[model samples]
Target: MEISWLEQVNADVPLDDEWLSSGEQLILAGMKVPKRRADWRLGRWTAKRAVTAHLELSSHPKQLSAIEIRPAATGAPEVFLDHQSADISISLSHRDGTAVCAIVPSHGVVGCDLELVEPRSDAFISDYFTTEEQTLIAQSSQEQRDHLATILWSGKESALKALRTGLRVDTRTVSASISDGLDYAIQDEDRADASVIGVSRGWYPLHVRYEERQAFEGWWQCIGKLARTAVSVPAGGPPIRLSGCPRL
Candidate 1:
């Protein structure tokens, strides 16, 4: 199945539970507080605003309520909705003024992440990346680190979303190696680790795409990993070409 990607920045937005309760909300690190809402409220509301719009449900406010995130028996985020049954999986993330929500139809898991392009301090880098991942950064050029950080953050967050664990899992254990565009290679963990990461884990192809929100000036991206079992062929090979990869 083809993955869907959507991006938007709302000039007039007010973050509130009324807006957030409807759509699954994600809050990042930085965001300005709306007039009446508290600081924490705005962060989440802004995230909701972006997510609802991405879902193409902004036109109908009530539809946001249709998207719900209730804890599963395993304590992971599981989407439950009677809105429209196209079989959608959603992941929400936000930081500062930027937020992102990714939805994949009829897919077991999906993830989306957005990050402000900021330089990482040596200490911060050391804290976040594992020894192996640090080696990759040390070998990278200045330009590569600046750009790759986004991929690193996005890939990890996206993976967490698909895994439905959010940040409950150790960040360092999940590593995403993006040589180009965005694809994932789990560095810190093995196949068993992937299973604990979410309802459907292990190695699955991730589709990632991003756009810079001018208003938020943040990079928002979408990622998806297709889950399938009983493979006709060995794993780690090219996907079976049904017709063709669809244009998102």
Candidate 2:
């Protein structure tokens, strides 16, 4: 897997039109809001970097503009090279001016999410979280509850991304548990302090899992405190070889 991240983006920074593929250019031109354009560009920039790195590592060197990341009909990201689809699954996330992309060598759907760890109101929790999840958050210490809520929220978002349904499917339908130590391998120097126990949707149990969920907790200077989770959703396909030594 190839994972890439960008801490900040200067929306005012000029974008070289030639650097973006035609499809990407179309998408860029359609964004009317400055912030939206910046966010979208940040995500695409990170994704392109990720794809370039992956291709180089795989011994399939390619130029940046030759690759394009676009949304599939299901809203999951798809990669295209020179107008032809590529054999890889891609996922993207952005929060608080930070963006990340995850690419896998197989068909297993992948999803990732990042969010700043902060306090959430009870009303927000009641509306978005499951009863069991709320109880767990409520039981945590005041200082820990914010982090816990962020983890739950991030995990669900990742899971939903893997499910390719986003938040359109009820968040409560997907649940994730976390531990206090590294359980997965993340590429960055930032170590993950937790692991996702399980992720499910409706009556169908998605065999999605993660070895680690990294919590910023003052470690990430650029984005302050944050939490991130990444998951792999199988599309009834054979398991792809995990690039990093992700211990479950």
Best by lDDT: 2
Q: Rate the local accuracy (lDDT) of all candidates.
A: 0.43, 0.58
lDDT of model number 1: 0.43
TM-score for each of the candidates: 0.54, 0.72
What is the RMSD, in Å, between candidate 1 and the native fold over all Cα? Answer: 13.2
Candidate 1 positional error at 135, Å: 1.6
Q: Write the per-residue lDDT of candidate 2 for residues 1-248, one digit (tens) a residue.
A: 33232222345223565557877889889999988888888777667666665565331223667888888787788888778898777778887676667666664556777787777999999998887778878887775677668767787787778778897877777766554421121122143222121111101112223223321110111122656566654322211212221111
lDDT of 1 at 109: 55
Provide the lDDT at 72 for model 2: 79
| Candidate maximizing TM-score | 2
